[model samples]
Target: MFVEWMMGLAPGWVTAIPGLSRAAQLKALGNGVVSQQAAGAVRLLLERAHRT
Candidate 1:
């Protein structure tokens, strides 16, 4: 895919990895739910609750 190739990954690397899909890769590369994002969301919610 053009996105993967542009990101410096070899053309076949996406398919080479088991369970990896183009949609998943694109989501991850774009606005996906990463660990840091989840953690930050939880932290923010907890802080907001504490402030109430």
Candidate 2:
């Protein structure tokens, strides 16, 4: 359930591999970042850059 929620929070479309091993799936999920958080960070950086 948690994984599904996290995936849903991603901004773009996410694809699931059908035959991935458990370890691979866990690794992918672990490496994934929240899209909304990343976008916010980028927006803040751009705003700061614009002020300079």
Candidate 3:
């Protein structure tokens, strides 16, 4: 439950994966972040800061 929240995954999303344990799912999610999405968020923040 905590892992799903931390990873921003929808409910039951983790259980859909086959053959992976909960621990492994949590580990992978912890280490995973979409680089493009992160970059976009940073850019948006910077732009907003500049405007303020």
Candidate 4:
């Protein structure tokens, strides 16, 4: 369905486009971003950014 269409189009790349508004799309983008950041292994960045 929608997931198949998206996965087919992007092939595992989740990007936050200008016109995409679906929760699943947003969640995909969010997860992609978080995964990328987490892959960097910079845990201190989260703490520093949120420790205001």
Best by TM-score: 2
Give stretches of model 4 more than 4 Å off.
Answer: 1-21, 34-52
Give the alpha carbon lDDT tens digit for every residue of 1-52 in model 1: 6765555556755545678777786775565344566788999999999999
Off by over 4 Å in 1: 1-32
lDDT of each: 0.67, 0.68, 0.76, 0.53
Task: Please give, for residues 1-52, the per-residue lDDT of candidate 3 as tens digits.
Answer: 6766665668667656889898888777777785567989999999999998
RMSD of 2: 3.4
RMSD to truth, every model: 6.2, 3.4, 4.6, 9.9
The CA lDDT at 1 in model 2 is 32
Q: Kindly list the per-residue Cα lDDT of model 2 for residues 1-52, writing each as its tens digit.
A: 3564776543222336567776776677778887778889999999999999
Give me the runs in candidate 3 sitting further than 4 Å from their true place. 34-40, 45-52
**RMSD in Å for candidate 4, one decimal?**
9.9
Error of 3 at 38 (Å): 2.8
- Greater-TM-score candidate between 2 and 4: 2
lDDT score, candidate 1, position 3: 60
Identify the leading candidate in terms of lDDT.
Answer: 3
Clashing residue pairs in candidate 4 are none
For all predicted structures, in order, the TM-scores are 0.41, 0.69, 0.50, 0.25
